[model samples]
Target: MVQAEPETAACMALRDELLGPLRKQTLSTEKLCEVGRLFCGAPERMSLYGVAAPHMEAGGVRVRGRTAVECTIDEYAGEAADAVALYAGNLREGSESDPLVVDLFCGSGNLGHHLGRRLGRRVHASELDPQVYETARDNLSRVGSGVEVEHTDYRHLIARLGARTENDVYVVEPPWGDAVGAVGLDLTRTTPPVADILADILRARAGKSCVVVTKTTTETVCDSLRNAFRGAAHLCSFAPSAPGAGVEFHIFRLGATDQP
Candidate 1:
């Protein structure tokens, strides 16, 4: 088990107090700050720790410090994980070769861990942030299978893995934006900017199948994908399950045209 930082320990303590019964209720700014100050010690630090409350409640689990702060708590919901698994199953159906599952931007290994168990495949997951990577590594290790987690840049991983072969499936869910709100059409606004690596991602998996699953407010990124992959691309949108929840997903599948 990885140790939590002092501030993160503070945040987790607050999470425990606020998540259970008060989960549904929205706390006033002053009241929330007051609660946060109990563990975080100061007003400014309390503000930082307070950000973890919603995410902790959503994820329903505790992890290491930086990971709890940097990564989305419950980003890969049950339905979304099922959708990705279903797609993988369909892609692998009647396939002759054993496919490898590579999660390019595995934050806390949520999607990768789910897919590893669901698909029973050799999964390689990576995160760039060292602290988050350690969290992912520890989390995936508990799964007790062929899941390998790495602390490296996605491009570096791709380079080391070399060219993609047939039956190799790459799943990417890059950071769309900072907040949980609407991620606009501009791909450049994303942390790694999908546009910057779309070509590389395609080239790496040139002869194989790859899926880029993301959440966005507009169809601009979809348009960009379609343009890049031509008729080889397929895009689908999943409506939000709840009224206040944002639109769930924008899935882009490529290389299926050549699949047998």
Candidate 2:
């Protein structure tokens, strides 16, 4: 039998190490395949995900992916950012300068970093988890100035900011369920239920301000939004990339009822 080269052996070992725990989870075959690709890259990139090499990439920009799972944001975060920018523009009519963008739950700072660069706006981002917050700080640091990533809860951060302007936009992508592979049709099951924050979000929104939430598809989310906010609300579906992916985002919009 032929022996594997040192580099090939290292890659395989690292892949096994990263995929070991993931395999034990309820991840679908498609998710497993995606995770497997993290190890097939340049040995350096593989090290970034496997070992302590600090780096991340999303939308063609380098980020800090502390773990293999962190790299998955690269697949869909860009599209989500695009949706944000479109809604922001629609919310505020003829704003000469970029709006104040706040990401309530900035995982890895992917959406916040993308918006900061794309819109040239001052972005305020927060993450509750300290370890993930460190990764987010590192990732946003590489982007440029005007982006702030804080290791703080979203509610506290919002409170500190106080009253917002018509040019303020808030973005939230909360954990849908308890576990990584958990699935459900109820938005309340999400960590920090959307209902808990809806009133505060509505009060924080200026006349032209907008709130964008990316959530797992649920039949009740739309009605919930409408009942909470008297302003215009729109919910659009994002199809999953794979047939059995089991993850789809419903981008919910509130505020700016008059925008065409």
Q: What lDDT, from 0 to 1, does candidate 2 have?
A: 0.51
RMSD, one per candidate, in order: 10.2, 9.1
TM-score per prediction, in order, is 0.62, 0.62
Local accuracy by lDDT, each model: 0.52, 0.51
lDDT score for residue 15 of model 1: 53
| Model 1 TM-score, 2 decimals | 0.62
Clashing pairs in 2: 56-63
Residues 24-102, candidate 2, lDDT per residue (tens digit)?
A: 2333333333344444332232222122223323322232222344332433445555666665563333355434678
Which candidate wins on lDDT? Answer: 1
lDDT of 2 at 223: 52
